[model samples]
Target: MERTTDPVDETPLTAEEYEAVHAAVAAAAGSRSRSLNSLFADWKDVVEDVEEGYSLCAPEFDDDLACRDALGRAWPLLPPRVRAIRRPELDELDGRFRAATVPWPGRPEEPHQWWRYRIPLVVEAEAGLPRPGGWPLGWEVLPFPKPAGVRVVEWGRP
Candidate 1:
């Protein structure tokens, strides 16, 4: 008798399975942005010591332009202790301008390139400030994979 491995019961995935696969692909592609931020944060404490604040201008998609503008508008509203740090020299330095093209599908081809600038601010001592939680739309938490591609991950906090 010939022995053969049970054909692994290969079957077409159902609708739910298809959706899951789709989500996983999208998450993988979007994870890069979050990964970059996490890497930067790891070194943030040291950077913060050198300057009161630091900022990064990460190019944003056109859809996110509103969020970027919102941040810019909010900057001036911050207290004096919280200053918007601008380094014209560092502007356009990261080269994160390209629109997302893979892993996630159906995204606009003409997504505007917006900049993500981060500035450090002192959390005011005053007790009366809106609680820090829940960012606006377009802000999402996604898993970041290891650089070596040796592992997989699930939805993660940003």
Candidate 2:
């Protein structure tokens, strides 16, 4: 994953630096099973000591439930018109239809490209957006120029 601006200081850390800080924090915490707040404090201190304008971003998730919870919390902060569409199966009729109609001569043929399918229901809003939460991480959020035939299945927050 690319380095994102630290939410606290808006400073970016190289991937290596980020990993090092995480390692340091883990070592400090030992096996005490510290709360996230304490762990974040450890991370903040490490970053502050080495790099003045940097703080760790949100920790990565290890489970779907945790990812969904994070999404729920972050949902209301998203920009307007952001949409969360479920992954459409390529074997489905609509998926097949979309693949046939969408012209992409240079598009790579790979399983990871499943998002290439036509998204049928687009839920637009500022929160509750789906993300690539599991192994073989996929789209964190859908990209623009959404599939040509997507319908506004629902609008606003649920």
Candidate 3:
């Protein structure tokens, strides 16, 4: 399900590396009572949204709601390392994004709407992280474990 404008720059991971990453990510997910498979699965559609340049998700329910809900629900469950890496930048960008967005600018009065643009990499990607490795050049090696050689990165990317 992963798609990128360019191929990964580094040498590809071997099967052992792949298992290690999966185990690490799974461990991290288990620590937080989440499922490794489920979180990335949620991201599947969110990534589609980024690729399609469609970010005007409604607060109400729809076909998109499942992925949206999953992402939101999975936020706290994400590894602390992952959140720490993405949060600060996403917070700042979200502020600017909420202000500059066209009609989709969410209402500040409604607290829930205020957070509509807080999606981490997706916001930055739409804001033009360039199109190459910008997805990760946003330096986003998501849902990964420690910054070891093994990272539960975009396994879906081929």
Candidate 4:
């Protein structure tokens, strides 16, 4: 996705929506932010880190989950000003990478983009974070196929 000039949604909120959101935010205790600071040390403290991680993971799901999970958690916390400036850099860079597979001639299953399969959405949508629209959403987990000639390794078997 090409980064826009402004990352935050600029559409104005209705008066009722604005009041309700303001009240909810105002009531939220500072304790929650403090606790996140104390416990979530890996939460990106610098905007540069979030931008860097976003660029890295955009290419494809990394060999492991660390980059994906990190992005999922830190993305919501990023400030709009930073995203406005840094997100555009992506247009110059490669488009977000997608790892996809095609259906076989006889395989009943449809083509699958086995991306973001196990990553956690630690920050839920209510937090107002902008999640990637293309994430593999509905299926919680995909059934992995055994490779040709590679038998399933059972626990405790040599």
Report every candidate's CA lDDT.
0.27, 0.30, 0.40, 0.30
| Candidate number achieving the greatest TM-score relative to the actual structure | 3
**What's the lDDT for candidate 1?**
0.27
- Model 3 lDDT tens row, 89-145: 446534553443322223234444443433332332233234332233433432222
Q: What is the lDDT, from 0 to 100, of the residue 45 in candidate 4? A: 25
TM-score of 1: 0.19
Report the lDDT tens digits of candidate 4 across residue range 1-158: 12344635454445664444333323332222322222223322222232332222322323333433433343335444433443444222212222112222234642232233322211012222233332222211224432232112112223
Question: Least accurate stretch of 10 residues (summed lDDT) in model 1?
Answer: 145-154
Provide the lDDT at 100 for model 3: 36
Q: C-alpha displacement of 25 in model 3, angstroms?
A: 12
Clashing pairs in 2: 75-127
The candidate with the higher TM-score, 2 or 4, is 4
Candidate 4 RMSD to the correct structure: 15.0
Least well predicted 10-residue stretch by lDDT in candidate 3? 144-153
- How much is the lDDT of residue 17 in candidate 1? 45
Better of 2 and 3 by TM-score: 3
Q: CA lDDT of 10 in candidate 2?
A: 42
User: What C-alpha RMSD separates each model from the true structure?
Assistant: 23.1, 20.5, 17.2, 15.0
Off by over 4 Å in 4: 1-63, 89-96, 99-114, 118-142, 146-158
